[model samples]
Target: MFDVKTIGIIHTPYQQKFGVPRQPNLVPLGTGELHLIAPFNHPDCVRGLEQFSHLWLLFMFNHTAHQGWQNMVRPPRLGGNEKMGIFATRSTFRPNPIGLSAVELHDIVIQDNCTILKLGSVDLVDKTPIIDIKPYLPYSDSYPLAKASYASEKPAIMLTILFSELADQQLLLKPQLKDLIQQVIAQDPRPAYKKKSLSTQEFGITLQNANIRFKVEDDIATILSVE
Candidate 1:
């Protein structure tokens, strides 16, 4: 049997799974921090990692615990109608529910006897357990000619997001985060089945400590409130 230990915990604005982008860098303004656990918090462990501009985070699907695996799984990008081999897609329900994300490295901070990694455009949810970290090597990682079987191109932005007076007032406390919230909503995070529905249902996403409520109607998403 192989043994893997969680080296740290990743903290992100995504307190829930509802609005998180499926892939890294998709939400350009989303930022995160990795807090190294006890023994691994030693500065010597991550020595020289700052030289790289990006890092690959290997983390476990802690939220999917106790879920059984399936040989075939549906991908959201396929409109949730088609089933593909589990290996072909990055589904959360795998034999080993481990996920990998590449994020831009911002800086490293050692404070209060803990080592923290500042990262940008992180896709992992808050409190995700990180198993390992590796520097991203562009020379070997980028494959311009490589074929992406189904996700050939990035998902298109489908909605125009507008903020209400109440939302604006709440956003005044952290105006810099407006772009991140807009980017997350523009991707239309609603489930595939709910995409074209005209129910005008208001959805809420927790960003940082604020609860943002918005509704989509006729392709326009308006922020109704933020608290």
Candidate 2:
């Protein structure tokens, strides 16, 4: 058996999986920080990391790992109706329960002797356990001519977001979160089945310490409140 160790934990605005972007860099406003732990927190561990503009994060699916896995899964990209081989999709349910994401590396900071890597356009949930980190080499990683069957293109921003008076007022206290909130909601965080039909059901997601509630009707997502 192979042994793995968590070098750090990533803190992102997504407190829950319900609203996290399905893929990295989908929401450019989404930002996070990786706080290295123990021996890994030393500056020598990341001596030349700052030279790279992006990095690849190898993280564990801590929340879903306990649920076990199956060989087949329904991919949200296929409207959650078609079953595909687990290896064929990016399902969190897997034998290894591992996930990989390429995120923009904004900066590396040392605060109170703790090493932290500031990241942008991340898709990881809050407090995600990171197993490993590697610099992203665009020359070898980028393949513009590559084709993805179902996810050939980036998902479209399906909904128009409108904030309520209360939400607008709350934004005054945290103006920095306004752009993040709009970008997240614009991608339409509803389930695949819900996206196939129009419903008046209200939805809520926890971003940072705020509880954002909203509803979708006729392709318009109205922010009901921010508590």
In model 2, which residue pairs have backbone atoms overlapping below 3 Å?
Answer: none
* lDDT of model number 2: 0.91
> Given candidate 1, what's the lDDT at residue 182?
92
Clashing pairs in 1: none
Candidate 1, residue 62: how far the Cα is off, in Å: 0.9
- lDDT for each residue of candidate 1 in 1-227, tens digit (9 for 90 to 100): 98999999999999988888999888888889999998999999999999999999999988885696899987889988899999999988889989999999999999889999999988888999999999999999989889998898988997999999888887887777788889999998999888857778788899887788999999999998888
- Give model 2's TM-score versus the native structure: 0.96
Worst 10 residues of 1 by lDDT: 193-202
Predicted candidate 2 versus true structure: per-residue lDDT over 1-227, tens digit per residue: 78899999999999999889999888887899999998899999999999999999999999899999998999988889999999999999999889999999999998788999999889989999999999999999999999888999999887899999989998987877887888999988898888877668789999887899998999899888888
* Candidate with the greatest lDDT versus the true structure: 2
Assess candidate 1 and give its TM-score to the true structure. 0.95
| Estimated TM-score for each candidate | 0.95, 0.96
